[model samples]
Each structure stands twice: as C-alpha cells, then as structure tokens.
Target: MAEFLQRVQSVVWNRKLIRTAKGHYLGLGPEKTEVGDGTDGKPVYTLVGEAYVHGKMDGEAIDFQVENQILVEKFELE
Candidate 1:
C-alpha cells in the first residue's frame, strides 16, 4: 500500500454529462476520440470510465443543469 501510494500523481476531475437512451450519467475521462459531429455542430467524445461524485450523485446534478442550462450530449465508452 505504501509503495503504491508513492506512485500517485495529481488528482483532477474531468467531469462530463453523458446522455443515452437509458438515462443521464456523470463520468470522468481525459482521453477520448472524436466520433462525429452532433446536430448542433459540436464534436462528440467517448469517455473511458464511470465516476461517482459524492454530494452531486443524487438529483443535485439535475438541478444544476436546470439552473445552468446544460445541454444533452452523446458519449460512448471505449
């Protein structure tokens, strides 16, 4: 455990809102691929891993989206 802890680097959150047929989800992934362009002409991305944000995990993200006018985007895990 101590040896592994020494190899740790910086901690950063690359949070993103992902929308799919099932439901909306929050994830983190810095590395991604440019799949294609969306209807709005924005570049689509693919995330790698799922993340869990403590307080924002419940319905807080939804409220924030409503307040901030977050757009629904497409993301594929790779």
Candidate 2:
C-alpha cells in the first residue's frame, strides 16, 4: 500500500483511493425529496430519497432540504 501510494494518487503523506479494493455507498442528491402520508389521519410529512451515489467522484458533496413531504430547496457544491 505504501509503495502504491508513492506511485499513484496521493492525497497526503500515504493516503490514497486505492484500486486493490472496491467500495461504494449511497449518497444524497442535490435535491430534497419528500413523501407524505395520505392516510385518513393527520397530515404527515416524510422525506424521500432518490438515486444513491451520483455519477460523480467518491467524495462529492451535496445539500438538500424537505418541507411538507416535498423538495423545498437544494444547494450546489462550492
């Protein structure tokens, strides 16, 4: 691992996004999706989720907000 980092992408001293192992995770999108409970009761709001990891890098970041079970706002990465 040390030798590989020295030859490949190195973020710091010896840290790198390796290739020997594969990893992934679900990431929040730039929009906030919301789901509402339409039951025969009180009005309820639930935040919904869309696609997992976007078609970007592994360390991309996003922001989202939900209100009344609906996407209220979204923020872009600076």
Candidate 3:
C-alpha cells in the first residue's frame, strides 16, 4: 500500500481538500477539519489541503497524509 499511499499523497498536497469517495480514510469532509481559531468559523472550502480520516483505524497506520480535493464553501437549501 506504500505505492498507493504515495500516489494518493501527491494528489492531495496540491489541493485544498482531499476527497476519497470509496477509499477515503483521510479523505474529505467538514467534521474532521481543524479550523484555526483565527479563521473565525468561515467554513473553509478547498480544492486541496490536509484532511482527517476516521472510520476504524489507528493514527499510526497513515502517519502522514497529503492530497488535493474539491471543496464546497457551504451547502444551502433555498
């Protein structure tokens, strides 16, 4: 999985949000994000950046991750 990880990482780093539809461990989402207090709850949206992946695995598995993503600033129903 090392090669798989490397390929994935490269794609993530360039973006502001990393999205993994099926294999999305450290994938894309708003819940796992860490918004700097200075950001002031703007609900950051990105096309690539660092992300969080939590399903049923430990942290040591993928110690470091880097990927890109498609982000949405907000979801509204009007």
Query: Which candidate number maximizes TM-score?
Result: 1
lDDT measured at residue 14 in model 1 versus the true structure, 0 to 100: 43
| Candidate number with the higher TM-score (2 or 3) | 3
User: How do the residues 1-78 of candidate 3 rate in per-residue lDDT, one tens digit apiece?
Assistant: 999999988765544443344545544434344434224555554433334545524644434332234343446543
Candidate 2 deviant stretches above 4 angstroms: 1-45, 62-78
Total backbone clashes of candidate 3, pairs 3 or more residues apart or in separate chains: 14
Best candidate, lDDT-wise? 1
lDDT of 1 by residue, 2-49 (tens): 766654433333434333323354333333312231234545543455
Candidate 3, RMSD to the unseen true structure: 13.0
- Which lDDT tens digits does candidate 2 get at residues 1-78? 888887554323332222211334333332343222224355444433333343334433322222234454444443
> For each candidate, what is the lDDT?
0.48, 0.36, 0.47
Q: Report the CA-based lDDT of candidate 2 relative to the real structure.
A: 0.36
